[model samples]
Target chain A: MFHLLDIIGTIAFAMSGALTAMNKKLDLFGVFIIAFVTAVGGGTLRDVMIGRTPVGWMLDLEYVYVICFAFVLTLVFRKKFEKLRTSLFLFDTIGLGVFTLIGLEKGISVGLHPTICIALGTMTACFGGVIRDILCAEIPVIFRKEIYATICILGGIVFFLLKSFHLDNDILYLITSLVIISVRLMAVKFKWYLPTLEKN
Target chain B: MFHLLDIIGTIAFAMSGALTAMNKKLDLFGVFIIAFVTAVGGGTLRDVMIGRTPVGWMLDLEYVYVICFAFVLTLVFRKKFEKLRTSLFLFDTIGLGVFTLIGLEKGISVGLHPTICIALGTMTACFGGVIRDILCAEIPVIFRKEIYATICILGGIVFFLLKSFHLDNDILYLITSLVIISVRLMAVKFKWYLPTLEKN
Candidate 1:
């Protein structure tokens, strides 16, 4: 069940990345590479930081296949999906929530502190997008006055707190995911933003 | 002192990165950011992987100043520097050697195993350039059939063996840097390259 959600999240993330490349009018190889990076970059970073051997993608070749498939599918549908911005953002938002939950769950299971787990969750959900934006030569929207990573951290904390109360594992994951997705979507809809460069 | 050498290395690295960005005709802000990232990205990655808090740049504001200074200098001498690829490559090579030695020294100071120390050294000295090239939308030459990273690792091992023999710190740094720089320069002069993968 968990694996199913993970694959769904991976496909969604890859599609979002590929859509961004399409929007930018990059070549086919460029689109594939960006999509692959967006889908795997965050987990690779998290694993590397934690000293996890082989990295997540190296351990599972299926991830490469998934990213390739996503890239091809996006290319095939490029004309039909001309209005890709809204749909891509929606997919990316879904991925953000689910990936945050999974990252927090993995970190806690590995015996990390709660603060670190929250950080891990935020990184897992956001770093890939950060890298994507950086490579596309743009300032990272996620870090500068965006409510994106903050939503992930809040959702991660909720998971730990609920789990500590002996909640069902499935219930914990669902509620965590729901909270994040709802908060992020609502923020986008309302054009919400965090204060940037807070005054002392 | 090490701080002085670090500043020199930063200037060289930033100038190299800025030159590449200028070749690509990027804006002033883009050039500055690329130069800054090329200067500090590798060392920052090494420190983060080793779980070091307060990354080197955050510890000393001078690194930031160094990059800013480098940007202004590059802006002044853009045309002159552009016509001096040979000299720029020499400065870049020396910076690589210095960075490799510093990375190995930091790794040993932090008690990493010798093999991992070598890995960290190569990462610190070369990863920044790889990232810089990627951001410029070029395939990283270091990864494309080159002796770059491999040379850094070899010199790092030499550094470790000498340190283990209770060699003087200054002498060890000198010898290691010489070994790395000499081999890299020779490789370039002789047109040395690794064999490419056979096409299907």
Candidate 2:
């Protein structure tokens, strides 16, 4: 189930990246490159920082396969996907939750401090979008105004809080994912936003 | 001597990053972050890709100290450095050459292919600037025009060619650095540029 969710997250992020690149009028190679980075850049960063070499994607070609699939799917249905922004957003939120949990797990497995683990989770959930925005030549949207990383940090807090109770691993994962997804959904639905920092 | 060049390169890159951030009107924290990344971003990416654990800067606090020193120096002499563009460019080019050789050595140490090592060399020499440009919301200068990376690629080719002739390691390093530095200097003097790809 966890593996399945990871695949879903990768596909969603990849397609979102492809769509953004298309909007930027990037050529095919550029579009594909953007898509690939958006799906794996965050995890690659996390792995590198934690001393996990060969990175996750390099060890498993499934990521490459999925990103390629997402690229083709986005290109084929670009017009249709334009009107399906709501669905895309939903999938992206799912991605945010799953990726954060994955990062948290990796950090814990490495016996990292809770604070560092939270940071890793936040990076995993959000760095891909940060990278995508950077490549597209924009100030990262989250840095400007979004409740995005905040949600991941919150999820990490909840995951640790639940773990303290000695809850079943499955239940702990389920609750944390739900908390993240629901918080994100409500943040969007209610139009929650972080205030943009002023140029000083 | 190599270590000295690396420090010079780090200081130059950090100062350049600080100047760019200052131009963008970022606060002190943002300026420092930009400086830090500009100094170490290239090597960090290379180390991660090649599975170098803990990365170069993390293992050696000297990088952090130098970047901090550079940050303060840049802030204090911002106005004076504005007139030192020639010196800055010279140092940056030196950094490009030194960094490329360092990357090539690392790749070779890990027993990677010559082609992959060449790529690592170019990336280590250029990616810091790329990340800085991306953060500053501009298409990477190298990707858009400059013959910057091309010089590093040429240096890698020359290094391997000299290796085949059974040159001394020290002589090979000296010749390769000289080649990269001179070619970059001439490229700038000659106003050489890559043709920008057209939007299709």
Computed on C-alphas against the true complex, the DockQ of each candidate is 0.06, 0.18
For model 2, residues A108-137, the per-residue Cα lDDT tens digits are 999999999999999998999898888889
In candidate 2, position B22 carries an lDDT of 95
Scored by TM-score, the top model is 2
- The candidate that achieves the highest DockQ relative to the unseen native structure: 2
TM of each candidate vs. truth: 0.58, 0.62
List model 1 lDDT by residue over A1-200, tens digit each.
66766777788888877776656555454565568778988887888777664456654668878887877777677666646667767767778888898678668878999999999999999888887776556677787867888899899889888988998888998889889989988998998999877588
The runs of at least 3 residues in candidate 2 whose Cα sits more than 4 Å from the true structure, single-residue gaps closed, are A195-200, B1-44, B51-129, B135-137, B141-200
TM-scores of chain A in all candidate models: 0.90, 0.97
Candidate 2: Cα lDDT at B200: 31
Q: Model 1, B29-135: lDDT tens per residue?
A: 98998899899989987787666756788998988999999999999998786487787788788888889987887777777667667767887888788688878
lDDT of 1 at A200: 80
